[model samples]
Target: MSPYHHGDLRRAILTAALDVIATDGPSALSLRDLARRAGVSHAAPAHHFRDRTGLLTAIAAEGHGLLAEELAGTTDLRDAGARYVRFARQHPAHFQVMFTPNLLHTDDLELTTARALSGAALTDALAPTAPTGDDPHARYARLAVWSLAHGFATLLLGHNLDRLLGDEDPEEVLRELPMFLLPPA
Candidate 1:
């Protein structure tokens, strides 16, 4: 075994990648730069990740796992939806990479498994409102819920709604979303 593999090299590389992305966005990611920040040899990150795609796939997978944990905490779809938005805001770098399939190794087992776990958590939260059997409304309901949260998060991330939001906290605004968007309980 390579002596460079000694302590948590993979985790350190991944953490450095996330810090770089959080500061400079995904396009700024470079294994050499990350390795330097991680205090590892330039080849060390490559040894663990193979390439940028491999590293990004791991990041995206980890993002999905975190998202699953966030969504799983809420019993109600509305709260789950709010947590979805919060997760995006809290982990913008991960959020950006997780949804961009072209940037990830889409066929990787870890990525797909993590993605599925996140999807299942969201689906399960919405299951109570989802119509059973051959109805397409259930699928549409899921789409609508996801769309609402994603669109809101995207807009917030881009600061596109700052004029509309003015002085109010974004999280507070998001918490009010269910009052207007969700069906009466």
Candidate 2:
């Protein structure tokens, strides 16, 4: 590979890594394989990502950024929840790594910042529906919103809900579920 490829190596490595993860799952990912796919020297990926944890951490950070965009400026909880599922479906590889903290450098500053941004967006989006005060209802609503969105995203990504969902689109099912579970405002 040309040394000139270094200018684009970071993006190339991330794209290749995402492809590998999407095709064979995260366990199959290797810096050597990513370097090969990116047509760079084996050491090139390491230059950008010190190791696999570093690489996964970068991917997770990107995932959170995308998630924040999806959840931003939402006026409804169901809308935000649906956007969360959409983000997961659209970027399954990133989604998988984003939630699996053990596979990433959780202490990485960029990853932590991205995660906090996404969390803040979700909190803001849910604030309208969340009841005020220290009541169990407020706590339950907050927990339920996160659990329902994350659980559905996890299930959809794993195909664990296929038998339960039948021919229906999973996103549609998710959008409808919160409506029934949460009190309408």
Candidate 3:
């Protein structure tokens, strides 16, 4: 860590990269371009991120942290699935790159930590509310919640919701997923 400048260049570069990747696609990102945009020397980013992969990985990690925070804020585990979709909608930049493994280098420490915490938060968030059942039943129930939220977000992002809903609100569909998936009363 050079103290003269770039004291925290790693974070700066990641922020800049996420912005660029969000506005344009990942293919449009590059160290030189990021440095130029960040007003640092072209070599500055390398000192922190090494390459595009490192920067992308950092962004993904950051995304997971944000998701964890969002999930942590939910008071009702039963409603968290809908909140997950809302999180993705609000943080489209982070949300877009987070699920794409090809876009990130998984070996990065920050990325790994971020992913782990998100998983932990999910388990914590659901533990109290998960239906009482046998092992397979519990696993399937958890998967159903995760998948429904994930699928709804993917559809909303793909604009499929628009084609399906016309002018009506599709968010309601997201909110109702848990009710539909939970074992019938």
Candidate 4:
């Protein structure tokens, strides 16, 4: 196979990588396979990603940044949670890798940068609901919000709850969960 020019090879590999991850799951992602799909020589991805972990790390980083920006754009804090849910639903591949820490290369500079952006965005979104009292209260608020959103998404993605509830439009049930989060009249 021909090697791609350096300029576009990296992007092309990453794009192909995302597609592969989406359709085949992270465990099946192989740079050699990705390069084949990208139409570059097998070694081309190494020039950009160094190795399989490097490529996955980059994908994880990009996923984090995308989720961070999407969550940060919400007009309401509640909406931020909705956006998080929606992003996972829409980009299941990206969302899956973004949260799976073992797949991320902690030493990678770009990965660190992306993780920080994601952390900052989440912290900012949680700021409004932060407990008005001591550290414990603040911790609880943050944990509560995160757990609520994350648990919902995890259940929805894995079809655990859907199976339990027996397939009555999961989103509709999720939409109603937010109402419980609302302050009662």
Candidate 5:
């Protein structure tokens, strides 16, 4: 591959990797292929990312950071849930890599910090409506909220919701789902 001399090589490689992942799944990603796509030498990606695991870790961290941004400043759990769904739909490649722990270096500091930020954002969103207590019930409530949003996003991304949501807006469905699934507090 021709060496890429200008612009941000790291960002270019990451963008190329995301495009590959978006079209062919993460399993299809490779430094050589990304380098070719970025018009850089095969060693370029390795120089910036070290290896495939490192690349995936970077993607995961970036995804969490993006998710945190999307979930930020939202006090309503339903709104946060809808934002989560929108983020998944908008960045399916990052979403896919972020959730697949096997593809990441789970202990990477950046990944851990980004994940913590996103987790905190989600927890904060649920704090307003969640039962006030440092008890198992409160923790379960948080888990349930996360599960509902995550499950819905997963189903939507997998296209499994098409049959159930046919011609209906998924975000609208999500906004109304908790009303039927959870008991009023």
Candidate 6:
């Protein structure tokens, strides 16, 4: 790889890493490959991320933060769910790494905090539709909502929904998914 100077080496390395993950899956990501993609020395990525796990941790943290921002924009649970799917579509690399905690430093403070913020945004989105006073049911409802959205996104990303969805937009499908769970008003 031709050595080059990047005004923002950290961001450049992260961007290159994400591209690699997106194109080849995280299993194929290597610091040396990222450095080459970034047109920097092999040691350049190590200086920014320390190791592969550290790089994945940064991606996970950034993914959660982006998801939090997306979810926080809307109070409607359905809208939030749609946004979740959209975020996955927009940042498949980050989405892939974010959910696979085994690839990350789970105790990393940045990852933990970003994850908590995303969880809070999801919970807040559920607040409008959540039943009153029953914490157990509320908790269950939150899990259900999260599972539905997350499952749908995962399936869509993996192209597992091709037969079922055909030409339909996945985000639109997710926005309409709640209708199947609730009876007519």
Which candidate's TM-score is highest?
5
Clashes by residue pair, model 1 = none
Separate clash counts for every candidate: 0, 0, 0, 0, 0, 0
Each candidate structure's TM-score, on Cα atoms with residue i matched to residue i, is: 0.91, 0.90, 0.82, 0.84, 0.93, 0.92
What is the RMSD of candidate 3? 3.5
| Tens digit of per-residue lDDT, candidate 3, span 6-91 | 55667677777778866886778899987876777888887777688777777788889988988885555445776688778877
Alpha-carbon runs more than 4 Å astray in model 3:
1-8, 131-134, 166-170, 182-185
User: Counting only residues 3 or more apart in sequence or on different chains, how many pairs clash (N, Cα, C under 3 Å) in candidate 6?
Assistant: 0
Q: List the residue pairs that clash in candidate 3.
A: none
Task: Give the Å shift of residue 95 in candidate 2.
Answer: 0.8
lDDT tens digits by residue: candidate 2, 98-175: 989899899999999999999889878778878766788877876788889999899888889889999997767776
lDDT of 3: 0.74
Pitting candidate 1 against candidate 3, the one with the higher lDDT is 1
Give the Å shift of residue 155 in candidate 5. 0.9
> On residues 1-185, what C-alpha lDDT tens digit does candidate 6 reach at each position?
54656788889888988898898999998998888778889887887797999999999999999999989867477788889999999999999999998999999999999999998898888877776456898888888878888999999989999999999989888877655432222
Clashing residue pairs, backbone N/CA/C < 3 A, model 5 = none
Query: lDDT by residue for model 4 over 32-128, one digit each (tens)?
Result: 8888887788887888898888888888888888888887755545666667777778777788788787887887888888888877776677666
lDDT of 2 at 110: 97
lDDT string for model 1 (86-164, tens) is 9998999899899999998999999999999999898887877777545788788778888888888889888898899
Clash count in backbone of candidate 1: 0
Worst 10 residues of 1 by lDDT: 176-185
Which lDDT values do the candidates have, in the order given? 0.85, 0.86, 0.74, 0.75, 0.87, 0.87
